[model samples]
Target: MNPKATRWAKSVAMVATILAVSSCDVLPRSGPTKREIYAGSVQREGDAFVIAVNDRVTRATAVIPALGFSDSFRNAGAVAADVIRPGDTLSLTIWENVDEGLLASEGVNFTSLDSVQVDGAGFIFVPYAGRIRAAGNSPEAIRRIITEKLQDQTPDPQVEVRREAGDGATVTLIGAIAGTGVYPIERPTLRLSGMLAAAGGVAVAPESAQITVIRGNQRSTIWFQDLFDDPRYDIALRNGDRILIEEDTRSFTVLGATGAQSVIDFESQTLSGIEAIAQAGGLQANAADPTGVFVFRNEAEEVAAQVLGRNDLIGAQRMVYVLDLTQPNGMFMARDFLIRDGDLLYVTEAPFTQWDKTIAALTGSLGSVNALSTLAGQ
Candidate 1:
């Protein structure tokens, strides 16, 4: 064996070894394939989660009530428009008629008393009346209380109270909302939806949008859509209620030969195989190998692999599932297969094609080099 020949033989062997490792399809003999596991075809027999075509009814129907304003409005209390705040100024006025004959005949006459501003403590110091707590009470109510207090000293006292400065009420909106700020409370009562509308509604990311209401130290979640659908759930906004709209963070990734390869935002919920594919833009023409489709998942050391083929899953009883796409009817089942987060879907290509191309390229290169050497020698 010449040194040159030996070197060429070694090079061919190395290339062959590379080809061997990269070439053939490796199928699991005892367990389900990755595609079967992903498709959920392999599962324990009689498992409650695994339902067969026969078990699924064709025309299952039920009446679902439409979401409406009445539903949201139900049980919701009326919210006051004006929310009282500090630093607001109020005016109190007292009026009485006095005879004028006193000045003309050494006597005085008066028709009304001067209006006075209420102090910071909501107290009004009158000529004869003493200090009084008037905060939080309505203007009319305050007038009646003050008039009664002054009745003992002044006869027929007519009293009036009016807001002098500052707004009557307000509500605060925050978090994932289009517009968040302090909104003036106008009416005597307002609903949750009204406040949300004033704050520019909830800013929901396509899938999960929720509004949270915080009263005192208690918290409650409200569905944004539900507010429009069911009036019963629409809550009343109080003076200091904090409304927060938020977007859920849980999401999943869809990749490979599907139409779209991106992260899908979901509310940490289960997804079916068909739904996942649709989210990824459906299957690609050349990229998807229906029979070779696989899903890889793990439970402790026991890894489950699903293989999808013609129309039926091979091991429909185990945790692993096999979806058969060869038949036209298989699509329906594929759509029913559920998918979970962190699950990887691989669409396999036809076997031996890559190997064939690699070998042909190497042989062609060798032939071209040999021909050049022969020409140079000649």
Candidate 2:
């Protein structure tokens, strides 16, 4: 071999060896493994970080309630029962046994009245009936009240009340919908999901969407998937309710030795750690360390304080959670582990993968040097 080629070969091997040695020290090899993190070692202590595998998460969840539908479904039953309110418009028709009646013409027995808007006092002004209370009563109930009041003025008076628009009882469908408009609550059974369908279904897949309900002073949100999976979330919409279908911006990033590295949108408002891994195409089988799957997230202040076993972690941020899929129990735990919005899921490369990559790189460099030496001899 040429002296220069030999020197090149030696230099390439030296560089590869240094790279391999440096790579191993980049991550700790002995202190703890994925199983340890999975088994309750989450905390922020000095320079170390870990997660607890027990009741801590449940407690945190209790403090921070699930967003959207779960919190807002309590009013579904009452909202489903439609009731008239101020700002409602109604059309009244009056009929009398004789041509000479108060509401009907002098020669006519029937009269179709004009539409009237309910006043702020929840009353509608009628010609002879005066101001009739209409709010808080259903259309049928309002009609009965008007008929009873008209009996004195007409001989056997018959009254019909038809609602033109329940101004206060409408749901405005907005954002990421096939159609956006104010949908009147004709019936009490108009549910959250039903309204979505009536508005020409969803413009985007619900899996990656969130449904927000904005009522008078209350606003809540729920994952589209969760809304469909549980019938309880399909709550009835009320008047002046605004339903918004928006794409959930929450995401989790997969890093390190995964089949692919990308930010995955939470198809639903809630996602499990396992599901996140699956979305990332799972860890690279050959390069992954089965015991090093980890999820990083910023926990609530209280939860962070508890996990770190410290009293002063008021606003601590970011902690690591590990899952060891090599064990059967690990798979079960992963399913229970919920991945929050803005989380990071990483699967460390197997320890030897570093050495393999380093060796391959060195071999390529040496091959080029050898080829050059051979060509010089030729």
What do the candidate models score in CA lDDT, each in turn?
0.53, 0.72
What is candidate 1's lDDT per residue for 1-378, written digit by digit as tens? 466765676566556655544543432122333333345432433321222221131111111222232333245567433222344456655665444321122243332333444446665554556676655666677777777876776567677666543433556788888898876554532777777777776776524677777767766775576666665677766566777778765455654456666777654234555666666677777545566544433321111212211234234223323345665766676665555545555444433433445566657656665565455445
TM agreement with the true structure for every prediction:
0.58, 0.70
Off by over 4 Å in 1: 1-129, 150-171, 184-189, 204-207, 266-273, 291-378
lDDT of 2 by residue, 1-378 (tens): 678866776677567655654554443342333444455533323333555344455344333226655454555565534367788788888888986878676788888877688888899888877788888887789888888878787778888887776676788999999999998776533777677777887788767777888887778887777777877788877778888888867777888787778888777655776788889898777788977887777777777776656787657556776677777677776777788777788887776876676566556656765676567556
Worst 10 residues of 2 by lDDT: 27-36
Query: What would the C-alpha RMSD of candidate 2 be, to one decimal place?
Result: 6.0
Best by lDDT: 2
How far does residue 49 in candidate 1 sit from its true spot (Å)?
A: 12
Give me the overall lDDT of model 1: 0.53
In candidate 2, which residue ranges exceed 4 Å CA deviation?
A: 1-65, 68-84, 99-108, 119-155, 177-179, 189-209, 222-238, 312-314, 372-378
